[model samples]
Target: MAAFNFTPSDTSLFILMGIPGLEAAHIWISIPFFTFYIISLLGNFTVVFVVGKEQSLHKPMYLLICMLALTDIGMSTSIVPKALFIFWFNLKGITVNGCLAQMFFLYAIAIMHSAILVTMAFDRYVAICSPLRYTTILTNARIAKLGLVGLTRAVFFILPEPLFLSRLPFCANQIIPHTYCDHIVVAKMSCGDITVSRLYGLVIAVIVIGFDLTLIGLSYGLIIRAVLRISSKKANLKALKTCTAHICVMLTAYTPILFSILTHRFGQGITPHIHIILANLCFIVPPMLNPIIYGVKTKELRDKVGKCRRSSLAATDFKPA
Candidate 1:
């Protein structure tokens, strides 16, 4: 086996021109992006803080919501700031190592987000479908253990992406066209044959995403069945409403992922651009929208945020000095 000749490139390409055939969007794209980024950060941070501070919110569902918010914050942190810089300053160049680091955090948090969603689905299932057993099944200690387990699963599953990217030899063209380091774009730049890399990416996707989706679907299916069997129409409607936000979040997150994979694998030529846009949307849009969806649908989280805000204002007004 020939020693993998890994030559790190010093040439910095404009981020907009990093992708093979895609043109950069106008700088005005940053305006809406900046607004969305601010909202995502505030919303996710509020969820984490409120869940941590309130004893009443320290149950399985809220714990999972906290984890989800943390993942959302991570996802936003990994991509948006750098993207904004690239748009505003045209500072798009990244070293090979830097690119790998970005990909690691980006994909790792993404996997974490998926795992958190799966955990949340299980939480919902227990609360609704097995109410009698909910407390026994999801005790605080158990929730803590499950959270650790989910975090470990996410980290272990995504380790291969960064490891694979680090080993690949980069070509003389070092510019990544997208705003940040995207795994597909980075893999496409490898000078070596990437069949194994692509296959591994697909396999990881299938294992993490496929398993998560199946579990979510099964949980929801059981919940729906249980709701239908309930004698009270009011109970059934309320139960179904509880799931609406989660279902929407799952759809937004999964649809773009499936679209990106299908287009990348099967679609030819012009499809890659569409895939790139959709892939970007998958990361950007979901983090931006998830908090809003949760807040609008879950009165508990909304009320908690409102109470926290009021408490903060009251505290500020009571200065003794």
Candidate 2:
């Protein structure tokens, strides 16, 4: 833990501060984070449970939703537990290997979420614009292949970080300013020149988030045009309605991410805690809100959720005290 530490030893560690300048309020801030975790877990789990139990819910669209729910869970699980442990247990020091592991999962899962949203947009595009070809185009086998491709792509982009990071010389201080491990944040802590790391991260943001957003925008544009081409007003409305929840989820998922990235490189006037909070929100908000948005917008999911709830109630052993 000395200046210009050239290599990580068996005991080299990086300390994660829950939130700098607000140490006294760490526990207080953690309350809402904890709430988000619970709601996100239960809400996403319910989505999966309802979809699994109801045979009618077994479709390409619903299965994709289930994939999305699991991705949300992975995104949250990557950071929340360690963050909470830092807040509640004061266990801030993480080993080099541990920090690398966190960084890998955090980045990979977040990028995976973006990839899945893009897939969902494509699914809707096929279903709405080319209804007759939807099944043939997005078959069960094809979807599985797409899932594998997404998983592999995410890992490929993220695997380089820790590899190069392990070789970078660290400054005297090994403390990270936020709740979780971040690629750029950790890279900045290196005493060595980090030009390569910065550019690599920029390339990733461009290809993953920027490119995915472009695809999503184009898909929706075509979807809108296809809907307008429908002569029946009822059919047009139905098709558009099917996309509303997806649009909301996409906004929730990507808006904070874009804001954080833009602010990171250019927003010099922004406060550190504000940037960190927004970065955390990129993971927290969507997981907790995706199911709620979908359930509210889609009557089918809403009804199935209700039915599952009623069934659970009926099966409960309630008795007079």
Candidate 3:
């Protein structure tokens, strides 16, 4: 490692290119980027804060919503700040260790997001398909246990990524082609063999995200079957409506991710700028949209949000402002 041609010196740092061919438009790009960041932070935080304080929102479904909100916050915060720093200030130099830290947290939190969605799918599955036992099956204790398992699994799987990357020697270029550090991008920059890292990344992706997707599909399949058995069209619509928010969130979270993965692996002819844009979208779009989707689609949550807002407005009107 020490004798490698591209080994980092004492003042090692990786340069994060905001976007490959769109360097001149970084400031312009920051407009929407910052908007997404602010929305993600505000929306997700509101969900978590509102859910925590409202006693009525203490059930399994709401608990899962809170978990999802927290995951969105973590995912957005991990990558956005640094990305904005690069875009706004052109301060691209990130310490080798700093890059690894960002990569670990960003990827770890994303995995956690996937796991939370899977648990939420199960929550919906039980609620819709096994309504009689929904309460008994997903009690508060069980929700807490599921949350812990999701967090632990995310941490356990992603913890080794930084460690693995740290052992490999880096490029003298030290220029990452996107706004933030990615495990695959960083691994490719290494002078040492990246076959193991690549395989591990694929395995982790398949096992964690792929397996979760399979289960989510299965859960929804069972849910659809149960929904069909309802004789009343109105009742059937209502039951399916309950899942609208989660389905929207699933599409929001997974679509960009799958797009990026597919493009990266198979779309070799695609431009680098498009690839970078898609990569960033996977991180930004879901967090910014999940809370909005839930607040609008879930009637109970929307009512709570409206009540909370009215209370705040009244409190503000009574204040000395």
Candidate 4:
């Protein structure tokens, strides 16, 4: 197959290096990536399935969890399969349009995750601060609308990324150093000045991640105020405890992401392989851990999961051995 030559008239094919400087460990590294991908899919899907089936879990909080699960699945699926193919089979020729599509889905789902976290924070806020009006305020119709708004916000903001990226001429080398097509990596490959692309990317990042963090922080602030006002120490502790899982999930989702962004853009001293590893972790950790956190923290979800396990075991035992 002919590799894409730098020509003004044709689409460029980008080759993704799974991990540039650590090619020797590609196979070993792929093992953990594969494991995380599988766990992310199974864990998140179980959360969605269980939350969907259990009538008691038909509340705003669980509904948001379902949305988060779907986002996690989408985010991981967009990047990991291609990465695994590059790692396992050394097949890394991705067309320009294909790369744009992957970038679009990856960032869109990431923004959606941030939006879902904000909504989850709001849910906790209402449940804690205004318990009586919680159901009335966050009714099924309202939750669905919020979900739609979040999706629209993500899609609207992320749509321009691929559009702008597609227009840029890639006259330079078509090799991408990372496992997947990141916006920064792809944008910087263009022969022309990429100030517009870079600025737009930063603008979108701020609008999505920064805005969501602000809202989430505000929501938690109010929740804290409400918790502090409670007369009984046990009630206050209980209220604060409900937020622990969400806080952990939030940290897992954003901390690595922020670190990855900072290191990629400014950490000139950092090694390329380390930056790539952190980038991969930004996608992997939250999805793999979210369902486990919720399952362990929420008794209702834990009970339902246990029931599901027992039923499956019983069915297996009843079958012909």
Q: lDDT tens digits, residues 1-321, model 3?
A: 221223345337787887989989999999999999999999998999889989999999999999999988988899888888888877777888999999889998998889899999999999988899988999999989988898899889998888888999886667789899988988988889988898988899889877999999999999999999999999999999999999999999998888888998899999999999998899999999999999989888889888899999998889574
Worst 10 residues of 4 by lDDT: 1-10
Query: Per-model C-alpha lDDT, please?
Result: 0.77, 0.87, 0.88, 0.88
TM-score of candidate 1 versus the correct structure, residues matched by position: 0.89
Error of 3 at 48 (Å): 1.2
- The residue-by-residue lDDT of candidate 2 on 1-321, one tens digit each, is 222232344238888887898889889988999999999999999999998999998878888888899999999999998888877878787877889999898888888888888889999999998889988999867877888888999999998888888889887677889998888889988889888887987898788877898999999999989988889999988889899999999889888887887898799998898888888888998999998998899799899999988888987956668
Model 1: per-residue lDDT, tens digit, 1-321?
Answer: 011222345333313332235435636677777888888898888888888999999988888778787888888788778777766665555556777788888888898888878878888888889899989999888877877887788788778887886777767766566767777778888788887778888788889888999999899899988988999999988888887888888887888888877777777775555665566677887887888888898899899889999999999899796
Model 1: weakest 10-residue lDDT segment is 1-10
Give the residue spans of candidate 4 off by over 4 A.
Answer: 1-10, 319-321
TM-score of each: 0.89, 0.93, 0.95, 0.95
Count the clashes in each prediction: 3, 0, 0, 0
Task: Look at candidate 2 and give me any clashing residue pairs.
Answer: none
Cα miss at 119, model 2 (Å)? Answer: 0.9
- Least accurate 10 contiguous residues by lDDT in model 2: 1-10
How big is the RMSD of model 4? Answer: 2.2
Candidate 2 wrongly placed segments (more than 4 Å): 1-11, 317-321
Candidate 1 wrong stretches, greater than 4 Å: 1-25, 265-274, 316-321
Error of 1 at 81 (Å): 1.1
The full ranking of all candidates by lDDT, starting with the best, is: 3, 4, 2, 1
- Whole-model alpha-carbon lDDT for candidate 3: 0.88
